[model samples]
Target: MVEAVMLWNEPNNLSHWDFKIDPDWKKFAEMAIAAGKAIRSVNPELPIVLGGISPIDPNFIQLMGSHGILNAVDVVAIHGFPLDWNHWNVNEWPAKVDEIRAVTKLPVWISEVGASSFGAEEVQLFGLQRMSELLLGNVERIHWYSLFDLPASWTATTRHKEAEGSAYYRHYYMGLLREDETPKMAAAEFPEGLGICQWFHYEDHRLDSAVEWLHRLKVRYLRTGVSWADSHRENAELWFDRQMKALEPFNTTLTLCFTPEHLGIAPHYTSPPKDPNTFAEFAQWAVSRYAPAPVRTNSAYAMPEEMAAPSVLR
Candidate 1:
């Protein structure tokens, strides 16, 4: 079951969003606002999260706030990759969260933060130690990037793969487990009670094992996605049902994003949709299906309105 709804994934990043087409993020705010409202209409107590901002930029969050986007969300989130991708040091995490907090009253979340085992497994081990120390109580949530590495044969999703050089290749090594599901050294040190960011592809075979790992890790929260693009494929509902069912044991934050090829302004998945409401419709459908509001009956066991209000993590 979904504990919260995260509107999109890194709208400011070229890898996840086409900023060239909607340079001001006006379209992104519009779609997010609409989706947030739709989600509320379905489940008023469900918290709506503004997707985790990559690069952890305060100016981008300020810009989204200017468009009244922050008003729609109950929490704001950010993603960081200090060891591999970001220029900032790993110790600056508190300052980073402070910068975002100064701009908004909503609780902040470290939605994605990880160290890749690309060069040596020791780097990931050290990163996990430092990350847990710097981030444990600094934010509301910390979802490690993934449970399994991206298979080397599969392309890493990025706007400029060739331009990123070695940095782009690190994507495959960000996982706690290798592509063959062997645990990296860092996996043993993963802090308990923190979440995991493990996106499941359509009909992914790793879902069961992934859940087993989460159980072993004693993780209570999860951050995953239901691609809008994948929703257009055959047997999509069957796959979605199976995926969500398997994940029912944890408190999940469902990220509703990715433009369908047919709905995008351009042919690519990163392109903005021609009609932003199309994305809103998809968000509404997912929430209504996966985390619908409880039916009001004449029973006396219903939660009071105040008690039903959305919780920060749940």
Candidate 2:
């Protein structure tokens, strides 16, 4: 086929300039699989090559594994940029190390990536070789991201500019050759950007990570301006609403509200005169009194009140 026997899927690419970034890799991978299906329809026997610059999106891995397609790809690829996706659009790289290895249990490849830029030629080569060892040893099949001094237009550098024979500025000069495609000292050490090494041994996969992700929300997001009991209660409610999407995907809700015995308010509306400030204070009291009877961390975060007979709110 004009597109080659199989497609080189650049999951990380958007265009020559636009590189798509998906915060949720699983959903993004779903789309990728759908797209792959559409492509395969064009050439039934043709296999798909995934991971061109994809760099291991966890969400993507979950999607791929959930389906039975881990081995469906002809050549799996990796893009190891070694930074967060926000910085180098490659955050998924580190996290996806395991995912790629697992997927490569079938077939995997590295369509692109390299080492340090603006550093000596060896640094660039070293990064590529290091990642190559980890990936190659897993499945024994991969085409490294690249192997030559591609110009700045595609790779972004100017090693070719010195004219005084300074050898490493071709931006992606990981190839053991010159910009003219001539052989350099590194050319024969690796061939076609492919090599093999030991299977990866990452640090202990943290089990039941006790890392405190849900930090106690300080009263900081709650503006402590003019308020009474109601305001504090309402602030807690507001904070809950603001943070629910992050806190609860399985389930969550604002089940209660508070007021003084004489206020004659419902156990729901902590708004209007009853702003977030009042809500916070009310929540502090609620947790202090009726919070599940458990010794939660001394966190100053809770619902302004709990559901109970209207008289208890008083």
**Against the hidden reference, what TM-scores do the models get?**
0.93, 0.40
**Quality of model 2 by C-alpha lDDT:** 0.35
lDDT of 1 by residue, 1-314 (tens): 79998988988889899999999988888888888887877678899999899988899989999999999999999999899989999999889999999999999998898999999999999988898888887787889898899987778889788588989899989999999999999888888867999999888889999999999889899999999999888878778879999999999999988999888999888888998888878887787778877767874544345533232110
Q: Please, what is the whole-model Cα lDDT of each candidate in the order they appear?
A: 0.87, 0.35
Prediction-by-prediction clash tally? 0, 28
- With candidate 2 superimposed using the best TM-score fit, by how many Å does residue 125's alpha carbon deviate from the native? 4.3
Deviation in Å, model 2, residue 278 alpha carbon: 57
Residue 291 miss distance in model 2 (angstroms): 65
User: In angstroms, how far off is 26's CA in candidate 1?
Assistant: 1.0
